[model samples]
Target: MQRSDLLYGLIDLFESFWQMAVPLSAQGEPTDDAGPDPTQETRQLLTYLSGGLTDGAIARELGVSERTVARRITRLQEVLGARTRFQLGIQATRHGWI
Candidate 1:
């Protein structure tokens, strides 16, 4: 398998273990959408973006409008504290959301 795939898988395993081991109250962090990860749709969007797909292409592939795609990206940025697409991608990967 590719290095990126292995890294992503390992990150997911570690995150799953971390969640199982820690309680939310013990972590002392405010929760949103149930955890520190994006929703499945948001993860799919990030995957398309990381694969270098444009907004229009993603829209077509997902049967959504360009506007919808843009809005989702914007929402993800706000939720993830990202100011730009590059930052969003980085943050999503760091969160194991992509």
Candidate 2:
């Protein structure tokens, strides 16, 4: 399949998994804010995640310290209600925030 097809398929799979795994209201609520208006930094962070980079790699790319990267990632996790990096990716993809 094409890369686009694969990407969409993966998104679909994640959406389905979330729909089945989480309650309707619980699935919609993110811990940080109600709306999904991510900042430029957050967007860049998501782009880095899409590239499958580690926090260290992302910090290097953004010219920041790993501690800063970790802080941002922690905030992102709360904002997206994702317990892990993998779940963050899936949730971000599903919400069209990535």
Candidate 3:
């Protein structure tokens, strides 16, 4: 019963979000034009993301707070006009930024 309940709940949640999901082609593009070139520090930070490091790991390597790592990632998302880290990596690669 619990397994079925969890399955049904997930299906319902998927259905709700599916109604609002954008189509695939639109999903590939960035949310906006690539803004100004990111600073060198920003590029370095994103490089760590490319290497599959978590925010805490990045903070440890960079000697900053985890919150600072997160903030830089958020800013990178905005600058690259990406909605997610995966998208950010794609956009940055496309723009030859990283």
Measured against the true structure, the TM-scores of the candidates, in listed sequence, are 0.62, 0.62, 0.63
Candidate 1 accuracy as lDDT: 0.75
Which pairs in model 2 have colliding backbones? none
lDDT of 3 by residue, 1-98 (tens): 24698889999999998775432435455445677777787788879999999999999998999999998889877776567898778778776678
Which 10 successive residues of model 3 have the least lDDT summed? 22-31
- Order the numbered candidates by lDDT, best leading: 3, 2, 1
Among these predictions, the greatest lDDT belongs to: 3
Which ranges in model 2 have alpha carbons more than 4 Å from their true place? 1-33
Using TM-score as the measure, the top candidate is 3
Candidate 3, lDDT over the whole model: 0.78
lDDT tens string, model 1, 1-98? Answer: 44798889999999987664422322433333435556677778889999999999999988999999999999887876667788677666656686
| Candidate 3's TM-score | 0.63
Give the per-residue Cα lDDT of candidate 3 at 14.
99
